[model samples]
Target: MSNRTGLARVLDDLGTTLIDLVRGDPARAGGIGGVVIDDPHDDQVLPPRALVLGVGVREPADVRARLDELGVLGAAGLVVRGPVVLTDEVAAAADRSGVALLGLAPGASWTQLAALLRSLLAEGEVTDSETLGGTPAGDLFALANAVASLISAPVTIEDRSSRVLAFSGRQEQADASRVQTILGRQVPARYSQLLEARGVFRRLYRSDQPVYIADLPDDDGGVCLPRVAVAVRAGDEVLGSIWAAVRAPLPADRELAFCDAAKLVALHLMRQRAGADVERRLRADLVSTAVEGGAGAAEAVRRLGLTDQECVVLVLALADSHVDDPAEHARLLAERQQVADAFAMHLTAVHPRAAAALVGDVAYAILPTESEDRALRIATDFRTRIGDRVVVGVGPVADGLTLARSKAGADLALRVLRAGRSQRAVARVSDVHSEGLLLELADLIAERGDTLTGPVARLIDYDLRHNGNLVETLSAWLDAFGDVAAASAAVFVHPNTFRYRLRRLAEVGELDLTDPDARFAAMLQLRLWRPV
Candidate 1:
């Protein structure tokens, strides 16, 4: 049945239903005795109060089976005579089926059984208090207060984060000071499992009904408590759950109430989560806005409330899907403590990459210490462990405002890297001077290479290629000489035809041509190949 099917009439009247069967029976009048109903005593039973099934005489063969079926339909006990008509096999079968078999036929009547149940149901006052929070905290509080009074075990109301909100009765909430902050904090990973309960909370909160989980392991990983949490939500909003763990398996009514509690939590969670979202967005916006333009890296450091003096810059890039994952970013940020430990003796570092933690496809962090080697080591280590393509641009050691310029230097180091080959993290941009003699030499070659960009460059390239063999062009010249005995003899060609062309001087670049200027330029260009 849906949890929304709240019972309207009292248990007293429902208790009377058990008596009607005996009244209509013929041979079973005096053969049946009074009925007995057990008080639930905080045991959540459906039909709610304990109710009788059948009382008196030998039971029909299917009576216990029928009672077993009715137990699910919400039956409690059956008052049958001692001498049952059923065979021994059948009587034994009844015992195993969980039907309460009692002998009351000799003295009591159906009327007496009905009266007793009615009296008990009335005295228990099951009908008087049945309101389960009509979307009102007052209502929940009222019900919760009463439930706390009834329950012997401690009860707690917590959000998805496991932070207790409303707890009642004498149950002590976990002590905040006792080994909590000193050792470890109990932070729940709700984002991992919130997806499952989110749907139910949405439904319950909208309908103001209850949600139930009969089998209650939220996370099979064992860290999460394996208890059923009933959730209540307000339209599209999830608040929290009502946690109950006293019962072996939760009864239907308690399940229903848990659902109600879920709705309660959902209503609260939705509203709270929304405002929290806005606040986060605003904070993100402000932080971003605070750090823009040339002052961006510096401003970012300032906005993050971290000291900038100990920062050293290291740039990194990735080749995977981790461009902007928030959780991963947070994890990288949290790794700061470990990073500090790793670099304890070197220098203070402002972790940089694309994100504050530099865990993304591209990022750079400024290390505070002067040792570029140590910073590079740390950055390179991170790159290796994460197995991502990262370019480490080590910024020079600069004090305060100069650090901003150092970040600029990091950018330049990366530019130098692109011009040639990859570099280690220890390579900084400031190490290069544009006016240096080597740089000037490389610049000359670059311009020369550009001017000879087409066929001339291709010719030089080809001549230098294939071990500088000019044989093909030489043969062509020889063929043009037309086999003249005199011309052929001049070029030392054998045979009367003399068809082979003379070797071309330009094509035979293998001789090095004995040109001092060209040789000198080539050597200088090779020496200056590394602009840095």
Candidate 2:
């Protein structure tokens, strides 16, 4: 329920737990716009009031130089690894630059710090201004802290899978296990196994009362603190749990209050879930409209916060979504949603303005960049990370109003990949343009109910009636550009045999293979036709 914002809010939440103020006043920086890692090798556009993580920066002089540089860029704060040496020059630089300086705690990684800051910032991004019990809707950290104050202990809010969602401050006061959980953002597997063996989770979930556990033996043979846990439930559905590290069992009155807190927690959890669903649907609608490109497209793009920026469109689709079993189809559908969510998170982390949404069976991403090569690299990395279950198609970069053309290109490339015509799992439109064109041609012919004509049709008919290999031989020859040796090798036949079949096909179908125009027409037909 703290009304702190920007640098002050970050300090209030994470200070002394994962970071400490090294020098300068945090209040000097008004509001933090975004979190960005400082990479000296690559140029970056620092959003206004950015909090830059000075990873690998240790020297006092380097810190001062970065502070000065960030000052001109209007950055809010700079965080470097501890123990930071407080020098007069660094202090003076911070004072002159009007930027706050902080240090990440020892044993805490730069990655962990960045994640914590971003999570805190994302909570503020929720458009809802509603509050539950004076706590902002979905503000789990504030709720966790409030619960900690009531219980007189540090606590963690965890999802059903035992993954830590949010944690209260004073975590250092807790045991080593609790600190480990906070650091890793999940209950360790060994601890979960021990609890499962004890039937603790089963008992906790079976009842609405608080479950208490005595001290447990740690991996180092040391005794850990006791804990009290209560499930957060909405009706009969268990949403998550709130666990408090305590020295002794809670009294009856406090236990009643703890149970009451679970009810409030349930409301917040449900609100959070519903808000996420609504946000996703809204984003999908905006992306769908923007990519369709019409009078409404400009407004949709602006609403998505992508106005006036060059962007590359990417389409992602499952390589194989078909299954005979109903249950298996449901599983695939759930997996698609999971992949889309992951993709959206990944793109957002890369660029704050990046947008991704599940539109129909395909997930479309609008990356705010002017380089198709960079877009291809991002797609390739995602494809590799997700394994071979998905394929991504990258389109040419386009401005906001022209996004439809980019989306069309991406759709064409994705269609080619999904058709199993290409060996690649990720491709740009330029890389698979020919294959995409053939697919378009197939679609056109199918729509028009066009049947095969000319020599190629005759060859297909002759092969079907006579059980001959003439069509295959002609396809191979055209694919190899009339190279008899290569075509024969490709079809696993002797050059002489291949030549005999080719000549027979030309004679029987009345095809003038020697003529360039005839060769082109036959090749085009073969490219468009798929044999039954």
Name the best candidate (by TM-score): 2
Write model 2 residue lDDT over 390-465, tens digit each, in one string. Answer: 9998989999989999999999899889888898899998999899889988899999999889898998899899
* CA deviation > 4 Å runs, candidate 1: 1-226, 230-244, 248-301, 306-310, 320-361, 389-391, 412-420, 423-532
User: Worst 10-residue stretch by lDDT in candidate 2?
Assistant: 1-10
Model 1, span 1-532: residue lDDT tens:
1111111111212222222222112221111121233322312223321344344235466555555554464334455543445555455544554444444333334544454333333323323343224322222323444444443333455555555444443333222221121112122345224535556445534454434433333344323222344554455545555644353445667655555545544544453455445544543443333222244645655654434454455544332224378987776554543342333212211221112233223344545455666556666666565443344566666644455555666656654554443444335655554423455456677888844432223334565664442333333333433335655555565634344222233333332324555444433433454211
* Candidate 2 stretches greater than 4 Å from native: 1-3, 126-129
- Measured over all alpha carbons after superposition, the RMSD of each candidate to the real structure, in angstroms, is 26.6, 2.3
